[model samples]
Every structure is written in C-alpha cells, then in structure tokens.
Target: MTTRTFTNRLTRALRERALSLVDTGRPEGLVFLGAAAGTEIAKATGFGPLEKVCKPVIAPSALVVALRDGELGAVDTALLSATGAAYTVGDVILMLGGGHASRSVARLASGAAAFGVGHVALGALMLRSGIRPKALQMSFHGAVAGTVGGMLLREDRGNWPLATYGGMLAALSALATSVDHGRAPSASVLAVGGPVFLLSDGLILARRKVAGGSLAARALDVGVIDTYATATLLLLTGTAAAARSARGR
Candidate 1:
C-alpha cells in the first residue's frame, strides 16, 4: 500500500481504539465515582478516619482496571482482598474509641445513609450490566424485606433511615445474585459472592440486635469482621475472573 493509504488506515485504527476506550471507560468511570463518593461521604460522617478515605475508591477502581484489562491472578486477588480487609478493619478500629457505647445514634444513622449512596451507584452498575427487569424488581423486594428486618432489629428498631440503609445493601446483594455475568466462566463464582456479602451485612445487623455478653453474641460480633473481610475478597476475586473471561472473548 502507498504511504498515504497506510497513514490513513493507521489514523482510522487509532481513532476507533480511542472511541472504544471511551465507551468502556464510561461505566468504569461510574464505578470509580461511586467508590469515591462512598469513601468521602463515609469519611464526612466519621465512619472512619480521613486517612482511610481512599480505601473504598482504591478497591473499586482496581477492580475496574482488572475488568477492563483482565489483569488478575492469585497474587492480584490477594492484594484486592487485603485492601478490602483493611477497609473493614478501619471501621473495626473505630469501635476501640469507646465501643458501640461511644458512638452516637446520629453518627451511626449518617454512616448508613452514606452507604446508601454507594448502593445507588452499585445499582447503576447493575443496570449497565444488562440485568433484566424481573431481576431488578426482585432486588427491590429484597430491599423491602431488609428494611423491615432492619426496623424490627432491637437496637435499630424504628429507625426508618437506618432501615433504608439496610434495604440498600440488601438490594445490591440480591441484585448481585441475579445479575447475568454473561458467559463468563466464573459466573457461578460471582453468584457465591453475593450471598456472602449478604451474610456479612446480616451479621452486622444481628450483632446490633443482640447486645448480650453471651458466646453467640460474641461470635456474631467477631463474625461481622470475619465475614465482611471474606465477602470482599470473594466478591473481588469473582469479579476478576469474570473480567478475565470477558477479556478473553
């Protein structure tokens, strides 16, 4: 081919590649924004220290990159899991301030609200992923159930706003269970994470309800941290696998 023709082809190819990046990058950008908004809002409400504000942002952003490029493996998965664990640990550390007794209801309520915003972002991601209308409806149902559960829970009983937060988290977890991860070989793996996520949050809510000094209550307390850490690790690993599958296609 002539030099002019080759130059024209090269330019066209580059333009197309750039456009493709923009297309995929849109959802990834939303993911990052969601994470950042969650982290910053949670920080503003004193959910955790300011120094840890980037925890939420970093975890989701890294997952986005992994999804886009399909760069993930055992070590990468470990790091992602570690990041999630650290993020949860930050909240755990807050209890050391004075335990639940030291935390005000308003602060707790605000933290839950901040997390609701994050869940909204997660919903957007779900829609972008092509979740069916029926599945979406079921997610709302999960929210309702969770809201009722939250309202009934002893410690947070009658706290409509906090119940709403529980609803949001429940919705996301439910949605995760029903989402079509496409033909990604790890679709089953992705489904597993959702239930674990639900379990983690359930433990948190249960812990609040049962403030006894009993062994079961203590187990619930510790389980909150353990399950949360495990949930994050599993969810991110599944995400990575799905990403890899997509990239291969």
Candidate 2:
C-alpha cells in the first residue's frame, strides 16, 4: 500500500480507538466502577449488604454496553437518575446498618444533585425534539426553585412536605416532556416510568411522615421499594433501547 493510504488508515483506526475510550469513560462506566469499588471497600470493612449495591449498578453498566455503538441521547438522564438512586438507596442501607451521619449526608446530597440534573436533561431533550422549549425551560426553573426551597425547609425545619410535592411535580413534568415529543418511543417508556417513580417516592415519603412500624407502613415500604426498583429498571433499559433505536434510524 502507498504510504499516504497507510497513514490514512492508521489515523482512522486511532480515531475509532479514541472514541471507544471516550464512550467507556462516560457516566455509566464511571458510576458503575465507583460503586463497585465502594462496595468492595464496604465489604472488606464488614459494613453492609454489598449485593444491594451490585444489583442497581449492573443495569446502568449493561445499558452502557447496549448503547455503546450510538449516541446516548436522553439516556444520560436515565443513567444519572440511576446513579442518584444508588446513593439514595445506599443512604438507607447505611442508616439501617447504623453507619455514620456524615456518610448519610453525602449520600443524600448525591441524590439531590441527581434530581437537579434530571430537569436540565429533560430541557435539553425538549430542545432537541423541537418541542415547546420555553415552556420546558419554565418548568425546569420551577423545579429548581422548588428543589432549593424544599431543601432549605428540610434543613431548617425538618419539613418534608415541600420536597415531596416538588419531587412529584418534577416527575410529572418529565412525563409530560417525554410524551409531548414524538421523536422517539423510548421517551414513551420514560413517560410511564416517571409516574411510577413519583408514586413510589410519594408513598415512601408519606410513610416516613406517619411515624411508622405498623403493619401497613411495613407493607407500604416493601411496595415502594419494589415499585421504585421497577421504575429504575424501566428507565435504564428504556434509555438503552432508545439510544440503540435512534442510531438505527
């Protein structure tokens, strides 16, 4: 082969390799690896149920593999939400195991950060779909304000009402955004998952406020956890399917 042709092929190969590296280093991989490492550390220390950490992390990692050949699209939001969920669940696990208060705070903060980012991701999706960007932006603004106000109230007065309502509204807004845009069917999956998540989270918050330990609270807790897990699974898998299908088109 001619030297120029050889050089061209070599450059193309290198470019592909770089792209592969970039894909592997995305949020899904980073989150999975970080969680895996943390779980290992926690196990070594005899801290908690490491299996609980593994289950949720597996879905995102699998999604990264499934969508490796295409653009991630709004799946980025799903991955992030999954990561947040991992932290939230981990916080519960830590608390149940009587872990440190500081650690619990850190986990809760991670979940909060995820909630904030999910709104921005939804806005970006709306823009891409050529939907009502202005309306979506307004929704995003309201969501952010609600989140901030709710966090402040929780911190200052230990009130959870605002936070619960804010979360429910954000979830509904996400559903509406996904449903309004006809760009992809994966979004439809998101639409369904949103309300399921909202319902589960709302029930969990209600149980918390009820000063539980009753049989009803215990049953509700079990249902919420299962429902939330189902929602997360739906989101992660839907995102992967969306990315793959989007690329196919």
Candidate 3:
C-alpha cells in the first residue's frame, strides 16, 4: 500500500480506538464480525428467509404489554419515573430471563432453527433454479446465525442473554468484516468481557478521581486498583457461577 493510504488507514484505526470509549472494548472486531457473519448468512440463505428466521420476537415488558392491552398509558412509564438509569438496559436484559419473555425467545429461536434447516435443504434445489448470488449470500448468513443462536440458547449456563448478544455481535462483525480484519472471538468472551472491562475501567476512573493526584500518581493508583478490583470481581462472579452450576447438578 502507498504511504498515504497506510497513514489514512492507521489514522482511522486510531479514531476507532477513541470512538470505542463509548462503544464496546471490541468495536472494529465486533462490527466486522457482525457484518462478515451477515455475509455468510447471505450465502446460505436469501435475505428474505433469513429475516424471517431472526426477527426479534416480541418479548415486550409488562409495561409494554400493559400498554398494548390499554391498561397503561405513556404518562405512567416506569422508566420515565425512575431515578436511576440502572433499571434501564440492565433490567431489560434480566427481564428477558424472567417470565414469558424467556419462553417466547426460546420458542422463536427454535422455530427459526427449524425453518433454517428447511431453507438449507431447499437452497440446494434453488442452485439449479439459478437464484441470484446476492440473495444466496444473505440466506446463508441468516441460516447460520439463526441455527447457531437456537442451539446456543439451550445452554444451561446463565449465558442465554449473553449468547443472544454474542450472536448479534458476531453477525454484525461478519457484516462489516471488510473494514475490520481478525479471527472473531466467540460471544462468550464478549459476554464476560463487557463486565470485565467496565469494572476495570470504572475502578480505574474512580481511583484516578479519588486519588486526587497528578497523572503519574494516578497511573500508579490505577495499577493498585486494577490488581485488587479484578481479583475481587472474578472471585465473586466465579464463585456465584460455580454455586449455580452445583445447584443445577
């Protein structure tokens, strides 16, 4: 590559790093992986069939369901009334594991997998019928993600939610693979990494703020904080996970 072109790409990569402060710890890798994943899906199943397989099944919240039933109104929204944002995204995720939403997601994933198998079987038939390449590309990706998602959802680990996020991230990474290049890490890494990075950064940011010293001093504080924080969080989360698993057995 020309020097100018190499410089431009390097510049973009640096910009991506800065942007990642608000994004995932793994962004380029995530987007490229999702997009590239979308591409493989395209190859296996056409876009239309794939969409049908992977559409978010409505696992609406109680408030949302109440709204649908006309029992609640926009003025009474809990999210709007809450004092903390903690209940926002975090709760929405946990809620999926709670009630009908869990069953609904599981059922939808299962249906998608079944339909995907049929699509793959018939993809063979359509090759002779001479379907367009673009359509085939989309179909393949849809089938892969849908099928893979359904299988992963059955994991007994507390990873159903993480798996959903992972599959979507992977599919998205696949979609944008042309821009970012790497062997995509599995969703499980990301599932844990999200909290790992957040807790690590939060502890550092907190110590830096509280240490009330110059940058170099604060940098030293960071080393101390990370050492303690990571050990503690890993111990707690790992212990909890182990207990849950033992209970299951």
Candidate 4:
C-alpha cells in the first residue's frame, strides 16, 4: 500500500477507537463527555455571563430526572435539585451585587449552608434506606482538602464566615460520599459527582484568590463548574431513585 493510504487508514482507525471509548453508556464516558462539554460551555459564555444562564440550564436536568424517577422517586430528587438551585441563585446574587461585598458574602455563605444541609439530609436518607458506603477514608480526605482550600481562599473581610461555610460544605460533601458507597445506580453517579462537586467549589474559591482578568481565573470563576456539579448531583439522585424503584419492581 502507498504511504499516504496507510497513514489515512491508521488515522481513521485511531479516530474510531477514540470515539468508541467515549460513546459508551458507562460512568466514565459520561464524565468525560460532561467535562468536555462543560469546558466548551465555559469558554463560550465567559465566566460572568455563564452565571446568569446557569439556573435555566440546570432546571431542565432536574425536571428530566423527576420524570424518569416517578412521583415517589421525585421527592428526594426534587429536594436535592431545589437546594442546588437555591445555591446557584445565591452565587449569582453575589456576583451581581458586587458593590455590596459584605452583603454578598453573607448571601453566599447562607447558600453554602443551605446546600450543606441538603447534603446531610441526603446522607441520612441513604443511611435510613440501608445503604452502607465503603469510602470513609476517601470522604475524610476530601473534607480535609476542602477545609484547607477554604482557609487559603478566604476573603479578606469575611474570612471567618466564608471559611466556616466552606468547611461545612466540605464536611457535608464527605458525609454524602460516605453514604453513597454501596448503592447501585446512584453509587456510580456519586462516585464521579462527589469529586466534581468538590472541584466546582474549589475552582470558585481559587478564582477569588487569583487575578480577575487572567484566563485561568476566568475559567475558574465560570458557571461551568457549578453547572456540571449540579447536573451530576441530579444524576446521582435520579439514578439512586431509579435504582430503588427498579429493586421495588
């Protein structure tokens, strides 16, 4: 065969292989696609503009989840998504009301606290339903990392409150992770969702510490992380509900 023909064949083979890897129904493929889409969306909207659009984009994911899970399954799923929406709105408020830094911080802190509460509630529900998570070590480590990162990124005037909220969020996330261990469909969802949630928060904090005009800072500050985090959370809750429903049948 000619060299050009051989090269073309090789390229096509490689492309097909890559596409196959990414097109699977597995959790890994979902994560890969989610992250890639998130990155592109972040770039397109720009950080500030993205926040304004986040709530609308995320609401539909929750609705689809509710529909798939059914009325009984929708309860927890709806609660989870509602709390997430509240948090997103709070974040947007903080971003828009930039002139009132202290008030904005307070609003953000309140939202974080609410989100943390939701995590704790979800963990409790999982435990009540007899799901025993096997990843305490992972959860603990995540909590520690979140605490340190929160402290490092604490705002100047609102340091104490913001750090406290950050620590709370981290702790709640760890609890949720621990509760997600042995569950079926939801377990897989949380496996990826939990870490991405942490990444989203960490990036938000990091952006606050960096220069606003820089590319890294803009990326960090974008709604993409929040969008991805919320979407994964919906997936986690929805899958868990679906799993329970399937088992009940």
Candidate 5:
C-alpha cells in the first residue's frame, strides 16, 4: 500500500477509537459532575452537616442516571429533573440533626413521597408512550411484594409508618419501571437495572433491621449502595443509546 494511503487508514482508525472512548466515558464523567454539583449545593445550603458524606455518596450516580434519561428523551426530562431535585432536598432534610425521631421519620417519609410522585410521573409517561397494560400489572405485583417484604423486615416496629411510606414509594417506582420497560429501547438494561435498584433500596431497609455493627449489615449496605450507583449509570446510559438508535432508524 502507498504510505499516504496507510497513513489515512491509521488516522481513520485513531478517530474511531477516540470516538469510542468518548462515548464510553461520557456517562462516568457525568456521574462525577453530578456528585461535585451536589456536594457544592449541599455545602451552600447548610445541608452538608450529614449529607456532606451521604449526598456525595449517592446523588451523583442517581443524577447521572436522570440526566442520561433526559438526554435520550426516553423519559420526561422535566420530571426526571424534578425527581433529582426533590431527592437532593430530601437528603438534606434527612441529614439534618437536632430532630426528634418522629421528626426524622416525617422527613424521610416526605422524601419517599417525593420519590413516589416521580415514579407516578414516570409511569404516566410510559403509558402515554403506549406501554402495554400487562407490563403495568406485573409492575404492580412486584411493588406489592416489595412493600410486604419491607414491612415484615423493618427493624423498628415503631417506624412502621415510615416503612409503609417507603414500601409504597418502592412499589410506585417498580410500577414506573414496568411501564418504562415495555417500550424501552433497551429492555435488557431496564430488566437488570430496575431489579438492582429495588434490591439496593431493599438492602438499605434491611440494614435498619439488622444490627448496625454486624458484618451482614455492613455487607448489605456496601453491596446495595454500590450496585444502585452502578446500575443507574448502566441503565440510563444504555437506554439512552438505544433510544437514540431507535430514533435514527
């Protein structure tokens, strides 16, 4: 081959590699961006007292997921944005010290409620997009199972109200996913990510039931949180890419 032709082929190959890297790295980069943004917001709002740790830990990945969903136009951008905002606010509330147990429960409940609203909105969007009714029904069943498991496994019986609220929210999120999965551009990602998200939350609840210092609790905590973050990143980014591909077709 001519030297000039060889050089041209090499350049094209390099360009393709560069594009691939950028595409793969964008989601992770966005996660870091969201985390940094959430940390700054927490500090500025005096919500950093506890969330300086927790918010930075979770919000980034979650926000990245929401942003990816928005970018793909697979879900309602406004609703996804609102969900992130609400969760951030709720985290701040939960982290706030100097509150009675009841007060803390109330704050947590409020956060869960906000999350439920987001889930309901997501479900509505899915339905509007023509998701099948069977998907919705299956989601409802999964939600019911989640609620029952949460209620039964709650550590503090006195916090039943909070547990109930959380269970309800989980159900709503599942319901939303059911609808979303029906028309999702990437059903496989949704299938895996959705269950992992639920499992993560379930583990979080399970931690409350288990002894704080126990190895089981610690394992559950780490496993769930990490899985949740990773799953969100995968699900959102995968779905977004798939949606874009479908649109192109």
Candidate 6:
C-alpha cells in the first residue's frame, strides 16, 4: 500500500483501538464492588481482570522492519555505557530526576528493580532487527514496558525515566545499526514503561475492580488493560512515526 494509505489506515486503526481499550475498561466500573463491597463484587462485576488480560493484541512487526531500512540507532545514539555501566550515559543517567523517574530500571545492579527494563531491552532488539519505531513499534514498546514495570515494582520507589526510557531509545538507536538480522525482541520495554503505563492502566481498571466489589478478584484489573492497551499504544506510535516517515520519503 502507498504510505499515505497506510497512514490513514493506521490513524483510523489507532483511534478505533483507543476507543476499544477505553470501552473495555468500562464494564468493571458499572458493577464496581467498592461501592457495594464484596457481595457486589462477586455478582455485579462481570469482567474479571483475567477476562480483560486474556484479550489478544495485534503486533506491528512491519514498522520495525521499516526502521531497519534506515540506519542503526547506536551509530547516532548509544545503548550501552562506556565502561559497562548502565547509568553513565547522558540520557540514561538523567532518568534520576523526579518527573518520570518512577519508571526507573533495575538490573543485577539495581537489584529487585522493575521489569520495565526488559521492554527497553526489547526496543533495542526490535531496532537491531531492522524494525523501525515509526508508529506501531514506539507505542507498543512503551506500553508493554510500562505494563511489566507496574507488575514487578511495587515499593512505591521511584527512579530515573532517562535511564529506563533513555536506554530503550538507545536500543532503538542501535537497532538502526542492524548488528544481527531479525533478532527476537527482548521483553525490556515491559520493564521501562511499567511505572507510567501502570499508573494509567491502574487508574482506568482499578476503579472498576473496586466498584465491582471484588478488590481481590480484580486485583489484576489494571493488568487486564495493560496486557492489550500497552501493546496497542506501541503499535499506534509506530504507525504514526511511519506516517511521518512516509511523508519524508
């Protein structure tokens, strides 16, 4: 398809997907147990988190392929640090600030850190495999990272967004390099976007779970939205980026 057509389709698809995720978040709100407590939760809340979590999401592999057509991201941006340190780089280190710092990365070094780091790692993988962040890749990468981060980290601890997202972006920069062809993506993005995405996902789903009256049953409610919404956001971002790229092309 022509770039314009692809852009139009992607735009429409994203709008639709956004609506879908929003809609999916609703049923829980209607019967929300917090309003009535436990009894209301069992009988009233129809959509359990599991039901929300199980829904399938479309993967935008093509956008990643387009990114490969350009150049390696590392040439212009570096994913790794100079002396094998993760936080030394300008961008990565900057994540220490309070703003988005909640999405901090933890490794053998960070210890007991959030898994959002994995999503960032995957971002590098996709880029290296020649996957462009155009629109789909970026959004999906970010969303997944955010979802995973929320799941793993819960100390209410905050870290640097730069190190986390910065690392992922560095990976995207490296992907532009193409050291290996089509390497399977790492789950790092799940680690990076965790804090941000979780906050958003929980805000949307948690209310419903509480209202549905079964806080325990819906404890994973935010996860339900994260499972699909995060992936969709990544695809949408990639699609939008692709659209912009096509314009330049």
The residue-by-residue lDDT of candidate 6 on 48-137, one tens digit each, is 332222221112221222233244344212321111122122213222221111233332223212223434544444444345544544
User: On residues 144-237, what C-alpha lDDT tens digit does candidate 2 reach at each position?
Assistant: 6476557647675544444544553464445443433333444445544555666655665455544344556555655554555445544544
Residue-wise C-alpha lDDT for candidate 1, range 121-224, written one tens digit per residue = 44444444344435664756576666566565655455666566666666666665664535353433434555665676666656655645556655665565
How much does candidate 3 score in TM-score?
0.21
What local lDDT score does residue 59 receive in model 4, on the 0 to 100 scale?
33
Cand. 2 TM to true fold: 0.48
What number of clashing residue pairs does each candidate have, in the order they appear?
0, 0, 35, 0, 0, 64
Residue-wise C-alpha lDDT for candidate 5, range 218-249, written one tens digit per residue: 46545654655544443444334334444544
TM-score-wise, the better of 3 and 5 is 5
Rank the models by TM-score, top first: 4, 5, 1, 2, 6, 3
Model 6 per-residue lDDT at 18: 39
Q: What are the lDDT figures for the candidates, one per model?
A: 0.50, 0.47, 0.31, 0.49, 0.49, 0.33
Best of the two (1, 4) by TM-score:
4
> Each model's TM-score?
0.53, 0.48, 0.21, 0.61, 0.58, 0.28
Name the runs in model 1 displaced over 4 angstroms: 1-69, 72-103, 136-150, 153-158, 212-214, 240-249
**Per-residue C-alpha lDDT of model 4 across residues 47-113, encoded as one tens digit per residue:** 4454444433443344333334344455555554555465445545554554112235666576566
Q: What digit string (tens of lDDT, one per residue) describes model 3 on residues 29-95? A: 3442343334234323434343222211111121121122222123223321121122123223422
- Give lDDT for model 6: 0.33
Where does the lowest 10-residue lDDT sum fall in candidate 4?
Answer: 179-188
lDDT of 1 at 122: 42
Over the full model, what C-alpha lDDT does candidate 1 score relative to the true structure? 0.50
